[model samples]
Target: MAMAVAAGCGGGSDSGDGDTVKIGLLASLSGTYEAVGTEQRKGFELYLDTHDNKLGGQKVELSVGDEGDGPPTAVPAATKLVKKDKVDVLTGIVANGSYKAVLPLVEQAKIPLVSSNGRPEVKNVDRLWHTAFLSDEPGAAIAEHVKEEVDGPVYAIGPDYQGGYDELRGFTETFKKAGGKLANPDGKTKWTPFPKTTNFMPYFADIAKSGAKAVYCFYAGKAAIDFAKQYAQSDVADLPLYTAFVTEGSVLPAQGKAAKGIYSVLNYSADLDNEANRKFVADWSAKHDTPPTTYAMASYDAASVLDKAIAEASKGGKEVTPDTINKAIDGLGKIESPRGSWEFGKTHSPVQKWYLRQVRPDGKQLANVMVQDLATLGD
Candidate 1:
């Protein structure tokens, strides 16, 4: 909803005469996914403000697009960011749906666009990439820990989108591999149109009839907490819960007691003790009014990687082209992220360990309990 614009043309040039390297932040600034976009934008802006809006001595100009207004609307915003604004890099496309809709423009222009968070695999089409997530990689993490102690009547639920399908597939594939059977048919993956069906009782009714001992799902932002409440109030209240990409600072507060026994497989758990995470969490809490989400943490890392690449490239006297930037990213190899040590995989996604977490009401505040040390799946 907020557009902050800057022209880096007059800034001092450390990267040779400082051609203002413009970066585009495309996301659903307004729509069903606006909550995610606002958080992502805040995270990106926080990094810029921390760095004084400079990357490699080149003024970083951010042009944000509202991708949720629909694909037709997104195309024009993409054009303005790419052609009119003349940005050097693209950094966001909030949800998996918007990312998928906007790829062609970035790919055609051969621009290196990073993401603010875990973008779906379908979002990538060669030059268009995200450092924050690995689609095939996360499948194993979700399956790895959930498979350990859960089995019998394992029900899966998610929206009928690619992201939903992917999460369901990742959890189910790993569950079955771990000797767990899908309480419902393998074909019952589709959940239906989202944002329209606010009441999840009917869905719960179906899952209850299926007789699942455990339930796993992938829902982000407000929808995640919505499902958590529904899951808690479901007739199958006795079932243990296993879900990936849940239990964050943002979602946990809304989830309240409904999330007491729910387990999550994620890249970052707020209670992590590592020095990097401790510092990140502390610094973030001090800086922002709201607690940072998993996406916010990943967005910070993405900015760090991009800024590192630009600085390294400038030091080597290389022009800041998309190809050169991507090469630097590919060569970044291993990084000490807030989550832990992560490296770029063959699929151009981050290969990192997933943490197993449990939600517990700590003194009237639900906090994530870091349980398993780590779990990972792909190359």
Candidate 2:
């Protein structure tokens, strides 16, 4: 597949010069997470298209790379972007493992990474910023709400990976703290083997036996489609389902009726009533048949951040270098986004509101309808 490129006005030159801002977008364009990667690319590209392919009042040269599914594929791609392409900034990692794998390259190059997705916990975060929520935040934001809504224990499950571990841990820890219980026989979150566990019947059978009042899980891409479809036909189909990423727009079309009525917690929904979101949704709808996903929204926000940071760094005749851009990002306050207005917190992640959403019919199509405001998180 051909990679998308947004050319700068001037001839191709290194970002060290003032003519262009070189941005490397490393995402899983192939393998299990292809759908997510596609959305990430689309979101970032949409922002560029709207802004005349410019950032900080300068032309942009975007280089896209495939991170695939994990570190083996991601590391090499990252190295090429950082060393060969010499991107001033990097963004768009779909998986947690990929994000962690590329850290050393980012640090060595001293380039800022405005990550569109897959936020992982790390000790050194001086050069990292995420448009996406921390893996744990989605679950933690909704744990108390789930506890209040469900009468009894909730059975938690997710793919076996770093992202899964953080997501489920957030729910379990916060749920227990909120005076809730788990229905798992071992009192632990169940882990399905990543990218290998296509068949979830055994897991559903186990959930049937766990005597849980509801089920909560975190799955995305193809896995989400399989899980949602299988869960709908399972013996425990009547049980309420609460989740984070499973019912998102990227997978909702394939999930179809199976995803209906499922509750999810996320930072963005296409139906949100705000000036920025309305324009965003309208623009997205103009190009596609389906609504925008959180993946796309996050990537779009990454572009917005760079736009402001680059502009800020360029002021007062300051050079728009990566270090200067990084400092500009630190000083950016109250960013207006499709999700709403938010500002980066001390963690260099958006301190934003989480919303309760339900998959419901909008006219003829299904959408993640905004149910209510859940909480303001991301400290």
Candidate 3:
């Protein structure tokens, strides 16, 4: 609905000018995913601030555009960033639909999109790279664990969209393969009508009647908060909850007591005990009151990837063009990230470790505590 652009001191052309490299950030700055967009922007800016606003040893000029919620808003914003701003590279699409919508535009323009959030399955990935995991990865990573932990069948549910379909499929397919069963009627994953289905009481009641031992689902932003709060008061509140994205840092504080004891699977958590994460948390804490979410971590990693790619592309007097950057990205062996070291897989997403986390009390506040490493997953 609203579009905002900020330009730095640089030319608005993709000529690979040695002085500055222009980057476009398309995010949901308004609508349902606004919180995620804010975190994504902050994360990328933090990387720039620490690196002296440079990527690949070149000063950077950033152009930001609001992707809103879906294709309608995202396509227009992306067109402007590519056609008008002439960004050398693009980054920061929060929603899967937005990412899918702008794929053709980026591919046609021959610009690399270093996405910082979940993406749907796609065949041509020559110009697409994601710092975030594939949409189904989190569920897939935790499926075996959930299957072993629960004695009976698990109920799967999520928003009715491409993202939800991928997420639930990851769990159901893996769970069934691992000799697990679904408790939903006729062995189907329940689908809620997405952003439209705010009240989840009906779904909870269905879960109770299905005789499930545990529940697996995915929801983010406001939907996640609403689900957590309402689930706490539902008849099935005592059932074990297993999920991805529902209890992330962005919504955990708002979910509060309702989110406690919920188990989640993700690639990064603030409590991860690693040198990169320690520095990342300390640096992030200096500027933010709340802990950084995976949205922030993934976006921050996107910058790290670009930093290396740009520098590699600029080697031997070569111009830092999109083609060069895309090639450079393919050769970046491993990225040192807040989530630990990971490299781009065949799918152009991260081949990395996944962790099992539980919402627990951290001193006075609740946080997603890293329980243990679940599995290493990717393409």
> Whole-model Cα lDDT per candidate?
0.69, 0.88, 0.88
Worst 10 residues of 2 by lDDT: 4-13
* Candidate rank order under TM-score: 2, 3, 1
73-144: candidate 2 lDDT, tens digit per residue? 999999988888888899999999999889989998898999988598888778899998998999999999
Q: Which candidate is the best by TM-score?
A: 2
- Tens digit per residue, CA lDDT, model 3, 36-61: 89899989988888887788777787
lDDT, residue 213, model 3: 94
Query: Root-mean-square deviation of each candidate, in angstroms?
Result: 3.3, 2.1, 2.5
lDDT of 2: 0.88
- Compose the digit string of candidate 1's lDDT tens values, residues 1-379: 3334443432111234456666777776776566666767777777777777876555676778777744766778888888776667788666665566777777777778787665676524455556567543455576656666665557777776766676777777867788777777564554856766567778888878887777877777667877888878889777887776656656677777898888887787777778877777777888775556667777777777777877766665555666777666766777787788787666666777787788876665777777876576445
**lDDT winner, 1 or 2:** 2
Off by over 4 Å in 2: 1-18
lDDT of 3: 0.88
Model 2: lDDT of residue 291: 88
